[model samples]
Target: MTLGNWFALLVALVVAAEVVRALRHRAVRQERWRRFFRLRTTSWGLGILTFLLAVALAAPLLAPFDPNRQLDIVHLTNRPPSSTFLLGTDPLSRDVWSRLVYGTRVSLGIGALGALVAVALGDGLPFAALVVAIGLTSWFGTSRLVRAEVLSLRQRDFVVAARALGAGSSRVIVRHVLPNAAAPIIVSAALGVGNVLLLEAALSFLGIGVPPPDASWGNMIADGMPSIYTAPWSTFFPGLAISLVVMSLNGVADGVRDALDPREAP
Candidate 1:
């Protein structure tokens, strides 16, 4: 009935949509995925990403306590999780879980958006000029290194064959070179998402995070630090959330790496 409740409900709906979409992909693209089905790593990557994402999204609806509520300011200060509050209250008496859920939304949104921005900054846009742009942006300060590497790769038989087949330089770069180079970039982007979450929490801890009544894990940590000697749960749960989210991203990236690179498999 409160804003936290509504926020949580919105999370639940998004999660349901994600689940449905994943299932639909499985059904419709079953054969397509199966061709690479030996790629258990891909499935694992997607599954773990889906799981962590669902957990973060559903935080509001599933969390028992009203995350933003200020409980008994006196007795609740520094108290650990109990029947009364599954995750202890902060210095301000707000529920740690609620703030955590809201924080999840902020962290995930920023990571996703930031990665997209990075990707879009590449020059492969509406025209061939964009390809030049992408090249410039991607190589930026590393131009000398990239040029040397590309020169070496250009001598490979595949590159020679592609050139003979009438593939233009841009085509070769897009089809051949980029694919080879993308492995590390994709891995780095996915793995870095957890770092965004930590940053969000830190911001909240400083009281500069999400505005009041919205709740945030960082805010919870900020509130709990003084009471850490009393109610460890205040900081513990949010810290745990940050750890788990980061670990999940690591797992997802590992799975993706294995799936994409067959040579890595035994």
Candidate 2:
């Protein structure tokens, strides 16, 4: 019905599609999944990320007030958190909780979408140009790591045998080289999600992000700056969200790196 509703619907559809695809195709290995959960840091990271994503996906259902509608401007302006207002009212009298809930879409959507664009295109593209830019810039290390792995894998016995057995270059590379080289790429991707979020916050703080009436954590922080002395919660919650998300992502990346390392035992 509304833009936020549409965005929430889009997120739900994408998540459902991915789940269906994974179930139907068995995209990830059972052992790897088991191993992933066994890692304490990654498991915790997964839990944290899952909670944040759930909040984002359920924004329409969970948000109590309209994120955009200003209310009680006279009586409720900048009220502190109470049973009536979970997080409090912003200077505009908009529910901070609602904005934070909706803001989840802006922050995580940008991070996830930007990461996908970066990994898929490896260069600039239309539509998500800013995301692409961030992704492309962040992918250099991943590219180099992948390249080195590819070079090393090309000389492996399996690759040599695949070639000798009449396998095409493309098939050999895709089946053998790329699979072997996927560890660092996956780790880098995990780390890149966190980086993108941080960058988005920075850009939004500078007044160049999903603009007003549409709450992004960065812009929320910016909006609360003048009221820092009077209402600290407005800025505190969003900054805390950013910090936690980034830390969780980094933890996941580290766990994945350790998990996928040849030296580590499953």
Candidate 3:
């Protein structure tokens, strides 16, 4: 199988495992969800993320024009928002709204996949070299966090009882240690998504990521730089996108951390 195929399979398996785990702890999961939704910032952040996800998923239907297609250069180039074009046009007469919608897919996909790889494998390959690089480099902190949590959890009474009840090391770790240590892992992964998004944008801005014609927020901002004074929307919109996503992710992460806190558990 190809690298992408393997990655997909891994993600599927991880998601299935999580679903099974949640089902096994349905009441706890429901309570946690309640706590999570109760936070106003969490709801707001999740609302924004849900909207972006919908836009990304429906890009073909939502975007009026092809993100990379340049049209009517003489008349459409650098045009501001209007009835014909919502976010306006770029230097090449490409629709900003279309590019922005498609860019949401690129940004969120990379951020989510990179965070999953970092949290799951701790180190990985080059299916998407940028994703792999970001995941590999960023996992160290998460690994340390997991390790500390695991170390603390290993000595807990439940873990000791599991081992004493003839459970093997693997069983003890999976059934006793990991489920308890999961809170920090989840929180770290949530925060890591924002970090990965920022890193991807920085790399793209430096011309090393998500190559041209692919409307990354970073490169879009770079493209808008020369026209900043005359057509500020070009750079402004992309910068605003980055800021909003990063901030939303941070807020969601904070909410998840609080919601998952043992102290907050009923």
Mind giving the per-residue lDDT tens digits that candidate 3 earns over 1-266? Answer: 23443454345445444553453355355877766655567656765676676666666766777899998889888999876777889888988988987888778878787335433553233326777787779889999998898889888888888888899998887777776777789988888888888888888888887778787788788778888898899889988988888887877887777667776787
lDDT of 1 by residue, 1-266 (tens): 34665565566566655764575467465543333334444444455456556756576565666666777777776556655555656787776666676666545654454324423654223222322333334333344545655777788898899999999999999988776655555566676556656655665677754445555566667767887877787778777766766776776566555545535434
Q: How accurate is candidate 3 locally (lDDT)?
A: 0.75
Sort the predicted structures by TM-score, highest score first: 3, 2, 1
Alpha-carbon local distance difference test for all models: 0.60, 0.75, 0.75
Off by over 4 Å in 1: 1-49, 114-155, 206-213, 262-266
Task: Give the poorly placed runs of model 3, Cα more than 4 Å off.
Answer: 1-29, 114-127, 156-167
Kindly indicate the candidate among 1 and 3 with the higher TM-score. Answer: 3
Best-matching candidate per TM-score: 3
Candidates, ranked, lDDT: 3, 2, 1
Give lDDT tens digits, candidate 2, residues 1-266.
34564566456656654653453343256555544445566655665677678778698776778988889889988899987777888888888888998898778877876336333654324325656666667778778888888888888998999999999988997788776677788988888788888888888888876556678888888878888889998899999999889888887787677666554544
Every model's TM-score: 0.65, 0.76, 0.78
